[model samples]
Target chain A: AAGVIQSPRHLIKEKRETATLKCYPIPRHDTVYWYQQGPGQDPQFLISFYEKMQSDKGSIPDRFSAQQFSDYHSELNMSSLELGDSALYFCASSPMGTRADTQYFGPGTRLTVL
Target chain B: DQQVKQNSPSLSVQEGRISILNCDYTNSMFDYFLWYKKYPAEGPTFLISISSIKDKNEDGRFTVFLNKSAKHLSLHIVPSQPGDSAVYFCAAVTSYGKLTFGQGTILTVHP
Candidate 1:
């Protein structure tokens, strides 16, 4: 079974710069979710999309934006990157249905803002 | 305020013994509960989940029990092996698929 795919398994950026992270969800999955896990902390929900539409939002920062493309893949855009933004970014996908709640996660992208 | 909490930070079990991890939630609206196992530098792997309608769900060597009235859930791993050592996270979801995770509990099964 194909799992979710994330680009740039590891990233290093400087403060005040910009970065974009991409996620290719499992084939045929309709919903994509983004989460951030800070050092020593649990994963926090950032945002989610269903059918390419923004479905829910969580603690995502105002400087960050995300969208799901027609291909069911999603991208998270961050600007004016801050050192605090450094964390593990994860993407998860699920099919639309009663079992859609069960999300399959991708190996996270480790973002290090220098 | 943390809606989901795993009070224990770590647990140790002898191989072949049973390991139990507990989680508590304050949100009454949460209807679905899930447990995930995570290794360092990797994404969480889904273990088992139990819906509010079901009191218990079992798989292979893992089982999840839900007590709706107590707003508590627990994951049980029987015949624990050293390979099972890792972090376990408890997550809850309402009608929406958005997950609220609990601080993970590290479990070490000694061989």
Candidate 2:
């Protein structure tokens, strides 16, 4: 079975720069979700999309934006990168039918802002 | 205010023993619960889940028990192996796909 794919497994950026992380969800999955995990902390929900539409939002920062493309893949764009913005970004996807609540996660992208 | 919580930050179990992890939630409306296992530098993998309609669910060596009255859930791993050493997270979700996770508990299975 193909799992979710995330780009740039590891990233290093300087303060005030920008970065974009991409996520290719599992084939046929209709929902994509983004989460952030800081050092020694649990994953926190950032945002989610269903059927290419924004379905819900969490603690995502105003400087960050995300969108799901027609191919069912999603991208998270962050600007004005700060040292505190560094963390592990994860993407998860699930079918929108009866198992919509079950999420399959990607390996995650480690962002280091210095 | 944490909605889901794991009181014990870590636990240790000998190989072939049973390991039990606990989780508590304050939301009564959460109709579904799930458990995930994560290795270092990897994403979380779904291990097991139990809906509010059922009190217990068993999958291979793992079992999940839900106590709606007490707003608690537990995951039990029998015949634990050294490879099972990882961080385990418990999460609850309503029907909307919004999942609230607990601050995971680290379990070490020593051989």
Candidate 3:
């Protein structure tokens, strides 16, 4: 079975609207990371959550935020979406506090902001 | 600025031939390096990795060599198969769990 799972394989939102994306980490894993992939580019780290806390955040705009619940499921929220926000979002997970290496990814969610 | 870089935008290889993908990084603090393979509409899949402590790591047909002093790493796929055709991304792990990725190289294997 695939390790990580992301919801809403595709999403479309209007400019200034809020978009919520969800992700479920692999069972028993404690670290979850989010990344954004723009067209013809490599994936960019967005944020990481471990032990129900924000472990690290990338140089993303303040309009983007993430939350991890007790169950290890995480949610990425984008407020006031812009056309530039159109991209593929990936969720990955690894074992707790383990070296930030060997992360398993899920099929991403393609977001199109109009 | 792109901390990690994969200069080659694309490469084509004949089936059963060796495919070498190179990556360089400007960050000296990156202790772990990894390569990922991705197909269209899919997230990147972990391929191989090498820690800063080790110069090389191999698994089956894939091998990753890391040179800490030069801040360079390369992935070699022996006897590449058609199924191996995908976009390969090189990444480096720094201070936190954040990973810096390179603009991927698309590899096409012709049978």
Best model per DockQ: 3
Per-residue lDDT value at B97 in model 2: 76
Model 3 DockQ reads 0.79
Query: What are the runs in model 1 whose C-alpha is more than 4 Å off?
Result: none
From the highest DockQ down, the ranking of the candidates is 3, 1, 2
lDDT of 3 by residue, A4-98 (tens): 89999999999999999999999999889999998988899898888999988886789998999999999999999999999999999998757
Candidate 3, CAPRI quality class derived from DockQ: medium
What clash count goes with each model? 0, 0, 0
Candidate lDDT scores, in order, read: 0.94, 0.94, 0.91
Residue A77's C-alpha lDDT in candidate 3?
A: 93
**DockQ, 0 to 1 scale, candidate 2:** 0.65
Output the number of the lDDT-best candidate: 1
